[model samples]
Target: MSETPITISNLNDYIFCPASIYFHSLDYYTDTLTYQDSYQINGTAAHNAVDSSTYSDNKNILQSISVYSERYNLFGKIDLFDTDNHILTERKKKVNKIYEGYIFQVYAQYFGLTEMGYRVHKIRIYSMDDNKMYPIALPGENPDMLKKFEVLIKNMNKFELETFTQENIKKCSHCIYESLCSFSRLKE
Candidate 1:
């Protein structure tokens, strides 16, 4: 791999909250994710199916493994890669809204693959809940997308601490980690 890996600023854009990223940067194991992190785990499994589902040979897909970089100070796993494009991970929740964060996640994978000298063709978002996939191959790495991505990762390196918050949106009603999230206290 190159001395510095490709940048990872998209995560904050994905989450749509710079403060949340800031909280994570504080080295806070903040959430204390447990078996309660199952939704996330399930999303990961869905991504694994896509990453390793292989459209062909000579294109080796990987599971959850960090493609780290010392210079970029970036650390995140590729849910899928070794193909024409990369898929960050799968979305397990049954949602209709298009979560752009999936794109950021895929971009991170593509960034790492490119640094490692692989020709990335696209960034795909696979929703296992709906058995759907959206592939975005914008020429050579879209700069705007990447810029926002790196910005988020940069924010993640800030904040001394973080307090979790939630929306009363219908989506969060059945939250698995409700007991763990700080916001859950207020609901109680």
Candidate 2:
């Protein structure tokens, strides 16, 4: 509502569930009282450690860090950016499968950096689980995906409560909004 740009995290949330975007836009928060998830805590620690290492002894390896793009209205803290080599890396927690949202988030980072005049040659992801890095083929701001994202944002801006639906019941079951979600399939 304030003309603030939508973040890559917001895009990831929308990919997870359209209803999540709607609920978030309304400032409706899910109850986290019953959960003590360690995954989030570990992720934060990992990110901090990486950030510290980058700015401390290995600063030169990363360049053009924490870049923002005003044109696309997206911002991200890139883990590793080698300007001369034209490579960008995004770190992620361990998971069995790499989701489309992860790829798109990295792509958004690429879009932002390129718009700012950095030629990003490659995109990579560091997985905490294996302590290994995986290369991702650069999508280079695919117009099809951009169009879809724009449509989603436009629809979400309308603020229709009914836009929240039980599209993925399994994911909905684990959602924090499950208890308060009237559009849930569990209610049937």
Candidate 3:
């Protein structure tokens, strides 16, 4: 809320739904997510994997796991923070088995936290498939990656949408917001 141009949460808002992004920008971060949420599951898996494999605290590489950058107001959990190496690792989860793109989450973390003066070395994509994990590493603060992420969030923020438009899209498809969206009233 401190006027950072980017944040991990905002990136997620854009990913889920543009309307969600706008609502959050207006300071509406509620408990709309649950344990069964796929996004949570994927992110947790990625975090856990990195927590176990990389960045030993005893070595003085990582100060904390989920670091909150006061400068950019970016809240994100880093996979590995190599303070000694001056590097950071962010985990990205793909919706499909094949790794596509998760730059928004990765770079938003970098761009935001970098504003706070942390040298980010890499953003790793931890792709999941057949109950297995694949590690893909990308350079931190890549202009191409940052630009792509920025464009995405810009689109999400610029759009004006009716709060209830989701109802017409997939209200009957096991949506959590069906009732809140008033889809039930339409059928009645």
Question: Tens-digit lDDT track for model 1 on 1-188?
Answer: 33333334336232643333333333235444434333223354554444565433444555545675454555566665645344334344343544556555566666665666666555566665677766665425467866766665565555333444444443344444444345443466
Ranking by TM-score: 2, 1, 3
- Model 3, 70-105: lDDT tens per residue? 543457655555566655555445455422235556
Give the runs in model 2 whose Cα sits over 4 Å from its true position.
21-45, 50-56, 63-65, 141-162, 180-183
RMSD of each: 6.5, 4.5, 5.8
Candidate 2 C-alpha lDDT tens digits along 1-188? 42666666566666666666555544324434344223222234446656667434554466325656665566666666777688887776664456666666677778778887889899987777678787877764456756655565565445555545666787766665556567777788
Which ten-residue region of model 1 has the weakest summed lDDT? 18-27
Model 3, C-alpha of 26: deviation from truth (Å): 14
TM-score winner between 1 and 3, please give it: 1
Point out where model 3 deviates above 4 Å: 1-6, 20-35, 45-56, 63-77, 92-101, 127-144, 159-179, 182-188
So what's the TM-score on candidate 3? 0.56
lDDT, residue 80, model 1: 55
